[model samples]
Target chain A: MNSHLILRTVSKFLIPLIVVYGLYVHFHGDFGPGGGFQAGVIVAAAVVLYALIFGLDACKVAVPPSWIRIGMTTGVLLYVGTGVVTWLLGGAFLDYDVLRNNPDHPAGQHLGIILVELGVLFTVATVMVAIFYAFGSRTPDISDEDW
Target chain B: MLNLINAAAAQAGNVPPTLIIDICLMAMLVVVAFAIVRIRSLFAIVMLQGVYSLLSAAWFVSLDAVDVAFTESAVGAGISTVLMLSAMLLTDRKSAPVPVKKALGPLMVCVLAGAAMFYAIPDMPAFGDPDSPANTGPGMEYMTASVKQVEVPNVVTAVLASYRGYDTMAETVVIFMAGLGVLLLLGLNGNAGFWQAKVQGQNICTQAAPRARILTSPSDKPNTEPRAPGDPEPSSKNTSVKKVAAKKTAARKTAAKKPATKRTTSKKAAKKPAKPKGEAS
Candidate 1:
C-alpha cells in the first residue's frame, strides 16, 4: 500500500488546501452557505483521506488518540463554557447580548456567535475523527479482496 | 446560446429555470434507490447511497436551502460514504436476498406511505411559497430580529448560533457522548487496555520526560508508547507508529503466544475420547 506513490503524492498536495477551504467555510459562514458543522466535516475528511492513504497506526501517531479524547472534551467545554460565561456576565444562558457592552455596537452578538461556532467546529471535527479512528483501527475479519 | 436563453425565458413564466435539473435529479434518485434495492452487492449499494445523497444535496441547492445542501453534502455524501465503507469492511460483501413474501409486506408499507405523502401534498404550501405558514409567523420574526440583533448576513447562521444556541450546544454534547459511547464499546482497540496504555503514556511523557528519557534509546520511540502500560512484558511492548515497529511488536507477542497454544493443544488431547449417541426426544 505504501507503494501507492500517486495517492501519497496527490494527498500530500491536497490535504493542506482542503484544510484551508474548511477554515474558509467556517469563517465565511456568517455571510455564506456554510457553518461549523460543514467546516468540521471537511477538515475531518482531510485527516481521513490521509489515513486511507497511509495506515491507521501512522495516523494515530500524527493525531494521537489521546489528543482526540482531549479534543472531544475540550470542544464540548468551550461550547458550554461560552453559555456559562454569558450567564455569569448577567445575561440569560447563551444570551450573546451581554458578551460585550458598547451600548450601540453589535460586537457582543458577533463575539458570542464566533465563540460558540468555534466550539461547534471543535466538537464536530474531533468526534468525526475519533469515530474514524474507531472504525479504521479494527482488524477486519473480512479483507479487501473478499469485499 | 440564443435558444438556451429563449428556453429559459419560456420556462420563466412561473416555474424556476432549474426545474429541469430538479426533475433530472429526482429521476436519478429514484433510479439509484431501485438499484440499491436490487443490487446484491453491498459495496455497490453503499456507493449508490452516496450518490443518492449527492443528488439530494443538489436538489436542496436548487430549492434554495443552501445551508441544508451544505450539510447534506458534507455529512451524507462525504463522511457517511467513508464511514460506511470502513464499517462494511467488517461484514461480508454481499447482502442476503429476502424472500419475496417477506418483501411483499414492506412493499405494501411503502405503497401506503407514498399514498399518504401524495394525499398530504395537496394541503401543503407550494414550493418556495412566500406566504406559506413556514414563511410567515415566527420565521418572519426570526428573520427581522436576526438582522437587528446579530447583524449577521446569513440568517441561518444567526438562527443556529444565536436564537437556537441551546439546541446546537445540546447537539454538540450529543456528538461528544456518541464518541465516548463508541470508544467504550470498541475499547479504542478490540482489547480492553490499549486506551489506558496510551493515556498513561502521554501523562508519563509530559510529567516526567527527563526521567523517562533515561529508560529509552534514541531509536526506541515505540518503546515510549508501550513503556508506560507496564502490563505486557517489556520486550512485547514496542507498539511504535512505524510499520516495522508494529511488526516487531507483533512478532514478539506471537513468540510469547506460541507456548500458550501448545498448552491448549495438550489440554485438548488429554480430554477423554468417549463418543456418545443421543436419540431425538
Candidate 2:
C-alpha cells in the first residue's frame, strides 16, 4: 500500500492505543510519571493524526471546528466548576475537606480528577485539530501572478 | 584548586532526576530556539518552531508542571504554528532570516527576569522536598480534607475550580469576552457580505490556477473556468496571454465596426483607373 494508506491504517490502530495509554496515565498519575495534562495531550495527538490523513473538510465533518472550540471552553469550565462546587459547600474555594468534612474519603478527589481530566482532554484534542486545519489550509506563495 | 575541590565535595548531595532533566531540557531549548531563529527557509522555521515548543513542553513536564506543558505543546506547537504558517502562505518565501539587530534591550530584560525568578526560587521549597511548607500548608490540609467533604482525589482540580472559584469565574468571563471579540472581528453574521466578495475573488483565482497544472502556461487551456476571476492567478505566462488576448479581441471588434473608412479608400482607388492605365502605357 502507499504511504498515505499505510499511515491512515496505522493511525486507526494507534489512536486507540494512545487514548488507552492516556487514561492509564491519568488514573495512575499519583504513582507514575503521567497525569491529566499528559493524558489529554496524548488523546489530542490521536485526533490530530486523524486530521492529518483526512483533509481539513473531512476532519471538520467528523469534528466541527466550532465544536472543538466549544470543547476547549467546556474543559476550562468543567475545571472551574469543580472548584465552585466545593466553594458552595462552605469550604474555602477548593478546600475539599470542607466539601463534606470527611478527610478520609477518596471519592471527592476521584470525582474532581476525572472531571478535570475530561476537560483537559476536550480542550487539548479540539485545539490540536484546529491547529492542524489552520496549517493544512495554508495557501502556498508559489503562484507569482500577483507579483 | 584545593578550595574548589572542597566546595565540590560539599555540594555532592543527591539531586532529584527532575532537576537534572530540567537543566538538560533548558540547554536543549536554547539550542532549538537558536536554530529556529537562525533558519532561513520559512518551512524549516515552522518545523523548528514546533520543535522549540515541544522542547519547552518537555521542560515543563520535567518540572512536573503538567498543565503548562499541555498548553504549550498543544497550543504553541500545534495551533499557533499553523496560524503563523497560514499567514506566511499569503506572503513571500525565501526571505532572509529575520535579523536580531536590537539584542541589547531584550538581553537585559531577560537577564533581569531570570535573576528575579532565580531569587524567588530560594524562598520557595527546594525542589519537591515533601517536608516543604507547600506540602504541609493549608493547600495540603485542604486536599486531605477534600477527600472527606468533596469526595475528590485531584487536589489540583479542587484548588483550581473551588478554592479559586472567583478566579475561575473571572477567567471564564474573560474567555467569553475574548470569544465575543473574535466573533465581532471575523463573524459571518455581519461580515458575510464583505467576505463573500473576497471569497468570489479567491475562487476565481483558484479555478484559474489548476492545481494539477500550476507550473505550466495557462494559454494551453483557455476554456477552463476560473476559480476566482477578481483574484490574480499566480502563474506568470497565462495571465499575460489572457490580458493580451482580451485587448486584441476588443481591438478587433472595434476595427470591424468601422468598415466604412476602409470602403471609402477602396472606392477612391477604383476611381483612379488612369493610374493603372498610365502604368500599362
Model 2 per-residue lDDT tens digits across residues B1-281: 64654455457666444555677778988888888667777777887888889999988887777767766886678656765665565454456756569789889999999999999987886767888987777877886865555444555555554455456456545544544444444331111112222564564222222111121232333323344658755577767677546643443344335442232222222121111122211
Q: Write the per-residue lDDT of candidate 1 for residues B102-184, one digit (tens) a residue.
A: 67888999999999999998999888789999988899998898887899999999999999998999999999999898878
DockQ of 1: 0.47
Residue-wise C-alpha lDDT for candidate 1, range A15-95, written one tens digit per residue: 999999999999999999898889989999988888888766566667777777888888889889999999999999999
Once fitted onto the true fold, the runs of candidate 2 whose alpha carbons sit more than 4 angstroms away are A1-5, A19-44, A64-147, B1-20, B66-95, B98-125, B129-138, B169-281
Q: Write the per-residue lDDT of candidate 2 for residues A1-147, one digit (tens) a residue.
A: 124677788877887897798788677654444555566666666666565565433455666556756876786777676668777987655444444444455455455555655665555555555444444433212222222
Give the DockQ-based CAPRI class for model 2.
incorrect
Give lDDT: candidate 2, residue A142. 24
Error of 2 at B275 (Å): 63
